[model samples]
Target: MGKKKFHKIFISMLSFILIFSFLQPSQASANEGLKINADAAILVEAETGKVLYAKNPDKVLGVASMTKMMTEYLVLEAIKEKKIKWDQTYEVSEYVYKVSQDRNLSNVPLKIGEKYTVRELFEAMTIYSANGATIALAEKVAGSEVEFVKLMNKKAKELGLKGYKFVNSSGLNNKDLKGMHPSNSGPEDENVMSARSTAKLAYELIQTFPELLEITSTPKKIFREGTDDQIKMDNWNWMLPSLVFAYEGMDGLKTGTTDFAGFCFTGTAKKKGMRLISVVMNATDENGKGTYNSRFIETKKLLDFGFNQFELKEIFPKNYEVKGHKTVSVVKGKEKEVKVHSKEPFKMVVKSTDHEKYSPKFQPNTELLNDKKQIVAPIKKGETVGYLAVQAKERESLGYLTKEEANKARVEVVTTQSVEKANWFILALRGIGGFFGDVWSSIVSTVKSWF
Candidate 1:
């Protein structure tokens, strides 16, 4: 080959290699330099529902026993609404008895014709992930497991969880129930949820019922402390303090594993007043086996990234005004324009390096504006005239969890002082003066045009 031709071919191949390298799938995206080993994962700030990081977050996957978080939410809601009491006793059903007796599944054996308090069953389900206990609570709350499954789906919809399904109260595969799965659900069905939805569910659950932490944080408890059937119940979530796979600041959460679901976890931790919620679905080891600790390991990567990389920073102070939008025009008021500022402080979880990337995006409220887009006089101080939201300068911002949250994310901008209407005499004088001014201006323009 000619030297020049060879040089050109080599340069083109080098360029192609560089482009291909750039297109390769990265372990993470923009500022999140951590690699997570899971089919789907997400980490979010608990207070704001702002997603800090995500990996295939919307991919639908079997959530295994992480489905129990929904069950826990319903049970807590029932107690709060006075529909059921923690002390209420429930009779063991034929379905619950059979499932509880299976040693292969997680359960605290329940004998038929015996009564157990709601608190007992809840403890078992929450702490040990006892499938039968979860079902018993479901039956007690909704009259039948079938109806309870309906309630679960209803509440999931109400909560705005998208593309989620609950086949049974327990996160077990339908076949695990030995033909006692809820009616209308396939025998092979398993509960499924996206990592984003799963994290949102956990966020809402904790925000609504903060007291559930007292139970889930327990490392171990006695299922029937003094009875002959007493069994030592150990929490499936090993990330709690003092647990085998404990992580600092980790607390109440749920874990799951099944043949189809692999291992999944919905974990939360609080440190220095910042709480983070994370979900890892189908986590596996190097061998692709969903070992017991694989979920925790993947979860730690997320929590660590959140805690170490992000901080709750005040993006804008309360009453701060955006540049180029610091004031709004007012008609027939004491002032031609009025100063406007944010009604509340804008705070969000963001990386330290990201402060420079954010800029204010101000939107005016058209309802309060005239055809000229000027505010009418008699405006009240602190009135909402506009909204201010932040935009990332470079990179796709991880938005809020829900539409409602996205709407609420902005800060209201209000007038700094009220503007009063001008008096009729002054308005008439200005109107008459303005007429002569217009005539003179027209005459001057005509004179200038002629010259």
Candidate 2:
């Protein structure tokens, strides 16, 4: 009997220790050499929309054809709402023809008055990033480029992209530099957004229409399919395994570059059921060469960092046990205290650097539980008196804790067990016990302070 009692006490102490251990601060040294050279960059998880890593994430810059992703987003949203049909044939406008005729710019020139379905135009815009096709879809959707841009800005605002702005449905800029191909031309229109804001836009894209990957992930395609009018092209995201910088699992999103934007890419990849989104904007050569490789290499580095430095951890396993028993006061319980647990398991993505101080955090809702000091009676079996929340935290080498949202991640928790109401005699006994307990605890605290 003595051994059994000791074992129970040991278990209780261990549970208590484990629960509070999470409150102990933990930290790791951040490597200064890990920084990437980009005007701005951000890495995020597609599902949770968590910012995994960032560098100058809020620095606003022009996003060349990456603007096409938003254009495609609006285009797809239109199709989903049935405002336009994918297979429905549409006319090529004079504006589209003029933009298509730019010999220096990539295009799938639509013969004036020659009609094509929405699907054809969308394919050209997404795969080839044909500026003319982009403008055509914009005009088809909103009646004109000017109007489509309004819809783009409105959509950007709705996505919580507060600092983003769109000047045109097609991302052509308004610079008149003679040496550059597709130099910004007329009315000073260019799609501009910060790297962080850009990631938010990309996150919403996959979250809303995940199947859009079917098209974006395509490495190469024939624009007109079997007709002699077909135009074959490769995807701009050269990260695909079939092309250069083949980081395994890289599917699709978009890439943009111009004399002004430099080079930018929003890439997403999936490995073992986990998907990550990475964005790099305005990556330029250290020597001022301004090659496209800088953005691709830096993006690969970012994804590698995300996949290597962090991993998903199930903080609370299925039927996980959290020992929470209060024997202090039950206003009217048959017995003195009650035990509680969670009905479901909780899980969250944990960074490898933050794993040492993991713990289960309890966020009991006293408002609904009706008891902060002591339990009020009339408790029913299977009632939720409180919640068990598990949070992910990591200390920074700066000798400081990161703000709650930035450093801590939380998981879902619910209740399992319930307490029953006690009789009047039991309630009286509990009241007396609680009063003495409080007195004893205060006296103990006072005595400890003297030591």
The Cα error of candidate 1 at residue 256, in Å, is: 0.8
User: Mind giving the per-residue lDDT tens digits that candidate 2 earns over 370-411?
Assistant: 334356655555555545555435533211111222223433
Clashes of 1: 0
Alpha-carbon lDDT, every model: 0.86, 0.71
- Backbone clash pairs for candidate 2 read 173-184, 174-184, 174-185, 175-184, 332-421, 332-422, 333-421, 333-422, 334-422
Residue range with the least summed lDDT across 10 consecutive positions in model 1: 18-27
Model 1, 1-451: lDDT tens per residue?
9755565566557545433433232335632567778899888889887777778878999988899999999999999999999999999999999999998999999999999999999999999999999999999999999999999999999999987999899999999998989996999888999998998899999999999999988999988799998999988889997988888888879999998989889999999668999999989886777788899988888888888888877899999899988999988886789999999998877776777778888866655764455798988998788888777787544556765555566789999998898888877887899999999999999999997
**Model 1 off-target regions past 4 Å?**
1-28, 31-33, 332-337, 370-372, 393-396, 417-451
Off by over 4 Å in 2: 1-31, 174-186, 319-345, 353-356, 365-367, 370-409, 417-451
